[model samples]
Target: MNTNYHYMRFLVSPKTADALSLRQAIQNALVQTFGIVGGSIYLDILWVAEDGNEMVLRTTKEDSTKIVAAVTSASTPRISLQKESSFLPALGSTSVTLDEEDL
Candidate 1:
């Protein structure tokens, strides 16, 4: 319900990255995109999947665009944005229909 913030979900490629790797990647991307200022931006990792391939991140609305751009721009250990929303609950909803294999 917080409109001042944005939530994002990213899925890691190869499905083998850990939380630390994801954090480092994001930080590196931010730094690469906007130098040290961007790298210092405040953000929070709300949740990381048990498999360590998916995570939910929280940041200010103004910084959301920068974050999305930074994350997607990174090449190594590819990171893809799965979802983004102003409403935190919206990120919890599944956009894809689950198959038996996923269940």
Candidate 2:
């Protein structure tokens, strides 16, 4: 199976911007356009980095075509994306039992 990922990194000046709106735009695009199924925003960890900028999002593997089309035309205009490699390990080598309660 092919696993795809997308990452968007933005550089913003703190005093000259509203980070909330930017995040909203991205989140809206993810839901309305790309059809992202699940994730979380670490807002408390948002901050200016070593370059005196801030970071907001990190999404798991998603459809590349959808992701690109969604954010490319967003209002924020500052977000940029990068694709990364992800690895998954097999959980078990045998069939596992599932009880009625498990379901």
lDDT by residue for model 2 (1-103), tens: 6544333444443322455655665567657764556312322213324543544344444543454566565655444443223332221123589999999
- Which stretches in model 2 have alpha-carbon errors above 4 Å? 1-8, 11-19, 31-56, 63-66, 82-103
lDDT of 1 at 35: 96
Which candidate ranks first by TM-score, i.e. highest?
Answer: 1
Which consecutive 10 residues in model 1 have the weakest lDDT in total?
13-22
Per-model root-mean-square deviation over C-alphas: 3.7, 15.4
**Error at 13, model 1, angstroms:** 1.1
Error of 1 at 92 (Å): 1.5
Candidate 1 lDDT score at position 59:
91
Displacement of residue 2 (Cα, Å) in model 1 is: 5.0
The Cα local distance difference test for each model comes to 0.83, 0.45
